[model samples]
Target chain A: MPVTKMIEPILPVEKLTYLENFGHSLRAASYLYKPSSADEIFDVFKVAKQNHLTVTLRGAGRSYNDAALNGAGIIMDLTRMNKILDWNPETGMITVEPGVTLEKLWQHVLPDGWWPPVVSGTMTTTLGGCLGMNIHGKNNYRMGPIGEHVQEFTALLPTGAVMTCSPEKNGDLFYSMISGMGMLGVFTSITLKMKRVYSGLLRVKAYPVSNLHNHLNEIFLAAPDHDYTVGWLDATAGGSGMGRGQIHAAKYLHEGEDPDPQKTLRVEYQTLPATMFGFFPKASIHYFMTPFFNNPGVKLVNTAKYIAGLRKGEHLQSHAAFHFLLDYVPNWELGYGKNGLIQYQSFLPKETAEATWNEILTISQKKGMPSYLGVTKRHRPDKFLLSHAVDGFSLALDFKITIGSRDKMYAMLQDFDRIVLQAGGRFYFAKNSETSSETALQFLGEETVKRFKALKHRTDPDNLLESNLYRRVFGS
Target chain B: MPSTNRNSATPLKPGKCAIIVGSAKGLGGALARKLAREGFVLGLVDRNSELLVQLCAEINAGNVGQAFPYVQDVTSYEEVPALFQKILVDLGGLDTFIYVAGILLPTTPTTYDFEKDRLMISVNALGALAWFNVVAPVFQALHSGHIVGISSVAGDRGRVGNPGYNSSKAALTTYLEALRNRLSRYGVHVLTVKPGFMDTDMLKSSPRTFWVVSPEQAAEDVYKALRQRRQTIYTLGRWGWIMFIIRHVPSVIFRRLSL
Candidate 1:
């Protein structure tokens, strides 16, 4: 028998391990390769192709869905390649390998008076993951997504081509690949323009909103003056209290506002405290919070939070303290227990934001599976082909899952997708786990899907790159 | 028990050494006989020392090929590496390896025996992986060999009768498929055997059975599949279509059936 020549025995059975999404709900048994350089990543791709296996790209594996899982295939984990290649504090320009995290980036440039232009709610996310999903922050309405700040990038294509893309050169690829969700190629290097900061502290303000209408109106109007604006809604509230929440808006201090900039800018002063109340380790807070993971328990907490916000306050908060509330209690997601949790986030135009969300919140409460936490952010549209943003507002709801409630939760989320699509809304792939292929087609349209497929054909004719998310959202 | 050479005057084919795991009784012993009849130098491994000695004596009486018996429990995964190397050295060189070691504990819809389930999985699933991991690199270096794994048709669907057995077989079936996909390019053949009902001690106490075959007949079928280098086979063949339908039955309906 004439056998086809295969790559050498580089992938061993011992390399088999489980790769799970940030939510821990989606996972796969994959052959994991932690590559430290572009050449090593290429070797992994070669091995995957030779063995007729698909390769999924992973950077910190922070996606909440199946975006980073390739079941029974190969996963190229690029976190080992973390390296800050170049930095220019004078011009606020920096170049880095794909694996560098927001925590590393901020730590590297805070003393130089520069900050990442856009960052996720958690500081542990990688730059590659941020760009792959085109993540946005509370300032999305003004700053767009992280991809908008990327000046240029170089990627290793499955076709064995090292291509450099920018707005002026290979602009089509530059736009699409950023939001391609790691299907186009593996990013080797990325150049970005960081926002210059005068101080390490942000002036903050907090207040309460009465209902869904007030919540949308306040954020839409406040986004222009504030550098960051976010809202926390009570998903269990209903009947005149629907979408009732509190909004926190923050703005950067001017050069002269912070009298002790030198002291505040120091990494030690800006880092989050490791312990709470000077004694309790923050790592174990999740265990204490686990008792309140149920609907009735969470409702009480949300009510207490809303009542506390009614006091109305303003104060200067450290940049890290203001941006990384999700990191306050380490492994807080574990509070939801073994089944984990899922976030269903939808972006709707300003015209239908209030009504659509009102219906969603009411239905969830009626079903007795209300979300534990609801976060709202203002967003403006972007140029990425697979863009999830809209010229309106986005609401993300986190629901606790149990073995008895999993199937019902998924069915309810599908209903939410229907309502969002009917209102001309879009969804962020990184957040939602249960969106069907038809929902994706409805949101992205036939023209954009065709164009994406054409690009995939040119870059990877053999179709060697795939993920559980890709197959779920776009048909196999 | 000690390793004994039978038909020492018979000259074995070059590189025709084979090892039959669980080769003391039932399907394993029958397959060993078939391979010996085909002029292979055989290594027989099993935990039942008395049965191992008896089977070795029976094969030695044929005086056609050689047999070497090694007493081993497949569940002792830690001992697999050294024993595998010893078998390779004792037989000179290995061209084929068949892992048929498995256990079926009594289970019903109402029973949830963690001890029994854990033992079955450890022996049937993880044991195959431990031995196969050692065998894979050797065959990859040689760029040619045969790996036969005995899975089961019970893995085709999730039945309520035997959750642990079904899951273990499902894990083995999927692992064998991955091995076949990876090793085929190196000219190494990996065959997955999914047998239906068999008239052996493992299933003799069951009340209802269908399409049951004798151990000798099943062994012949497996030998033919190895010779033909088939990727997967269902001994008695009809189980393939039966499983194809069973696998497609909607879960809501399938769950209501006793099966």
Candidate 2:
């Protein structure tokens, strides 16, 4: 009788390293392996199964918390697998590898008069990560999440099964896995339907709003007419000025609107300037902004911005300039320092948005750790199983973390969660890091949580897929 | 680097490679000798150059198994990657990774020394995490390896006397449990040893002590557990029952007395 030998995968153990989230707040040590193909990913799964190590799927590590972190486990970095497989300019449909970033996708299709239907504030996020989190753009109220724009995807499960999922085929898996936070499987390829655009420019109008009521009202009213609308709140402002800020509403320019559509729609015109005023380097801007990360300094900057908005101006801005404001200054998040920053974003119903946000802002200021920056946007609910949207408004607040302020800040955030939950609000996993298991269950409902867990068990019988965020919120 | 075949007259018996971190003194040093006697090619690592060199020489002189000395500070997390790779190359192959490096600075409820508390957390908890991160993936790939973490019984409950020590152990204990959960499917054995009182400098500052055993005796228990593939164990055995009672004590009443 001939004996068959079992061969173990040859892992690159020297590749053990550290990985951090986008905000740089949460970090973990893991063995990072960049697999170039679905076959390599399968080998990784085989290795992880044999070694009893959980595997986390990572694309650009753009999450705000531990969603991409798996401590003392294996991190499968898909960035190397980036390749645009197919594109059809006529149909506005494109197929790309999971690691293809929004920046790469937009740059490739923009000259052809197509843009990603939805994108986050930063374009560096990967397609797999976006679908995993089901990110939304300023136009969320109109287009829904990026998942709604996805046509289909191929995923590799832990059970060594390759599944092709779409709305019509394996519908439950499609709806659940889109916002599943990379728990079900690894996305190998994604086919997305891009939004067709006539021109690159958007007619943007900026005006200042007064108090919490006007901020919410103005955005709700403007969203109906504009393709994209967002508000910047002066968190430092108190009393009648609470939630007072500026609103910028933008509308897409028709084909005939731009005198030279070819010139305006070119990638060169759509790209942000490499330098501010064409002299000072944009990459170094964050170092100078560091001095203003504190409460007093941010208050001064917010006041100046509000004062500048009082003039109420209108201008034509490119698509990149309008959508990717977070990337305007390179490494801008570094201004928050080594402790980094955490964002608390909540989605509330229109009926209770004003009242609930008012209480949250008041409590934040009262705690003496007011958020450095606040942004508000209108949104409509989607059908994703773990949706964080509502037919109302969403507020995102950025809090700078200091050596001694973490505990206090977390306590305050828990209080904010209580107020939001009472007002029937929901939380996004991609942002907020301090959400407790009970809060997740309350917002997602017992049925939804149970169903997601059931699907997870069925797909990953050995529980090979997991991340820090999944463990923290799901409490499994 | 030091190596010798002092027992050249006797046939050498080498089974598998094992690395004992903080093997310069105490339970770590004892465990190093025990594994060596069991024919494990050893990689003994510690920050104390003098003690580490002496231990390495002693092991080589015995010639039961070969030993390599690596001097490294456990708190220097960034340097772990290079040293980990070097140790793997020197050992040819690894089958067991034992993380016994730790520190216990005197802490009291009355005086809060941030520096001391920080050092304890750094060495006792975070340092272990850094080393474990390097070894886990290799073991997972091989599908057969042993990981042993030497935690303390102090982690069972938050005692008042040594706040930092108790909390660091608690964190380490919880982390090991999580690792066990993650690595169990691969047939990897993760052993968390929660020893009670051991005769070492670490416990000399305690207000009181009982059931203290020599490092040699404790090593015997640990080696037995490692061979048996036990998930967890309390050295001296009775500490398990004692901690059970201490853990269940209602906090409202347990707060009145220091264990």
Error of 1 at A84 (Å): 0.6
Best by DockQ: 2
- Model 2, A1-476: lDDT tens digits are 12323233234656556577787776665678889999999898888777666788999887877788765567899999899999999999999999999999999999998889998999999999999999999999999999999999999998889999999999999999999999999899999999988898999999999899999999999999999999999999999999999999999887688888888779999999999998998999999999999999999999999998999999999999999999999999999998788889999999999999999999999989998999999999999999999999999999888857665787788899999999999999999888878899999999999999999999998878877677668863
Which regions of candidate 1 are displaced past 4 Å?
Answer: A1-10, B1-259
DockQ of 1: 0.02
lDDT of 2 by residue, B72-189 (tens): 9988777777677656645545778998998888766678887888889999998898888877877776566899999999899998788889889999999999999989897889
Give the interface RMSD of candidate 2: 19.4
Which residues of candidate 2, in runs, are more than 4 Å off? A1-12, B1-259
Q: Which candidate comes out best when scored by lDDT?
A: 2
> What docking grade does candidate 2 earn?
incorrect
Candidate 1 CAPRI classification by DockQ: incorrect
Which residue pairs in candidate 2 have backbone atoms (N, alpha carbon, C) closer than 3 angstroms, thus clashing? A51-B140, A52-B186
Cα distance off (Å), candidate 1, residue A425 = 0.4
